[model samples]
Target: MSNKKPILAITMGDPAGIGPEIAVKAFSDSAVYNLCRPLLIGSAAIMSRIVKELNSRLKVNSINNVTEAGFQFGEIDVFNLEIHNPEDIKYGQISSTAGDIAFRSVVKAIELAKNGEVDGTVTNPINKKAINNAGHHFSGHTEIYAHYTNTPKYAMLLADEKLKVIHVSTHVSLRKACDLVQKERILDVVQILNEGLKKLGINSPRIGVAGLNPHAGDEGLFGDEEIKEIIPAVKEANERGFIVEGPIPPDTLYALAAGGKFDGCVAMYHDQGHIPFKLMGFVWDDDIGKMKSVKGVNITLGLPIIRTSVDHGTAFEIAGKGIASPEALLYAINYAVKLYNN
Candidate 1:
């Protein structure tokens, strides 16, 4: 392991959304500089604009390449992709211009990571619709990373201080996610989740696999996915010398995982994992009409290179407001450092 600080290439997500603002906001924290040699992969003009908007002390230093980066505090070292006029991207609006910029940033980051120019990659939120509109038809960061890196099998790992959850199937509808509940898929995710947990410092992970049906199919009374698919996966996992349990009821499993009954969990689908993890991390103040704090890290497991991202989305509602919370991005940066170190 290298004693020197890890170099992290962070993609500023969507210019039309809160990506630029949040990226600048995160840079204001000096702790991130201590953790890694952070380089922002986005337009320096946009970032500079956000810095001015926030009236932050940090300045943006535009660099044509990573080698020219200063990696200094009190300034953002941006691998400036001057592809579009930053003024053209209207906040809170979906446009191909914004999408193209965001897509380019991600592609650039992946290139740098694959070439070993950076130790890992951290991402801000990107709008799926916006990216697709720009002619980039990728679903999300996980898919984008998998495709660009040539990784076939990967799982979305949502983590916080309390519970850690990995999805067996994400970015799919309820119907399709159900159809995906097969012995092979579940076992694959379990292995991914198990390895991810150990890498995150849980050597002996107690994985709780959630059932597909209510009451865990009520012992085949409700649905047979538990009996037919999930059970066999669990049996195979245990037989393979894993500390596995479940086909446990979704509701019961989450509550147990939340209270620390398990080190991590393998969720059946996206919402089954995201809902609980977000509930724990995203705190909203109803009276204030804003989030008090947004916290959670999204890690893409089974990738060739490390990729960690903020667990939230591009809050188009609050884009350019300078009010977007940096808590999640900070957590993500920390996780990126941890993953790189490990």
Candidate 2:
């Protein structure tokens, strides 16, 4: 294993959103500098403008490759793609220009990682509609990565302090999510969740699988997914020497997981996992009319390269406010460091 500090490439997500703001904000933290040698895979001019508008004291240094990055505190290095003009993008508005820039940055970061130029990637939020408008048809980061890497099996893992949840199906409708609750898929999710948790430093993870129906199907009264699918999946995982408990009631499973009853939870769908994880990570300060802190990392497991991102979205309403929280981005960088070291 390389003992040198890991080099991380951060993709500046939709320039029109909070991506630029938070990227600048996160670099302002000295801790980030100490954790990894970070580079921005976006525009230097736009980042400079954001630094000046936000009145941040950081300096933007444009470089052609990772070797040129200063990786020094108070100075940020950007691998400028020069894909979009700052004047072409409007803050908080969805446009094809912003979409193109965002999509290109991600592609650049992935290329750098695949070529071994960077250790991993830490992405900010990008607008799905805008990306689609730009002609890159994909649901979310996980799909884009899977496509680029030619990976068929991948899952979204949202991690905070005590609560860790992995989605069996994400970026799909509730009806489609239910339709995806097959025994093979459930078993795959369990294996992926367990391996992902272990990568995050958990040894011998105890996974809790949630039931697809009310009260775990009430023993076939409401549904039998538990008996027919979920239970069998859990049994197979256990027989393979995994410490897993599941087909539990969704209502109580999350509560117990949050309290540290389990190392990780396998949610049946997107909302089943996101709502609980967001409830714990997102804090709203009504008095201040902004988030107190956004504190979760969205990690894509079973990818060819390491990828971690902020669990929040593009808060278009607060794009250039300079108050967007970088807590989540910071955590993501730290998590990437952990994974690299492991």
TM-score of candidate 1 relative to the true fold: 0.98
Per-model TM-score, in order, reads 0.98, 0.98
Report RMSD for candidate 2: 1.1
As a TM-score, model 2 comes out at: 0.98
Every candidate's CA RMSD: 1.0, 1.1
Residue 145's lDDT in candidate 1? 96
What clash count does candidate 2 reach?
A: 0
lDDT of each: 0.90, 0.90
Give Cα distance to truth, residue 119, candidate 1, Å. 0.3
lDDT of 1 by residue, 270-312 (tens): 9988998888888999998999988899999999899999988
Q: Global lDDT for candidate 1?
A: 0.90
Query: What's model 1's lDDT at 286?
Result: 95
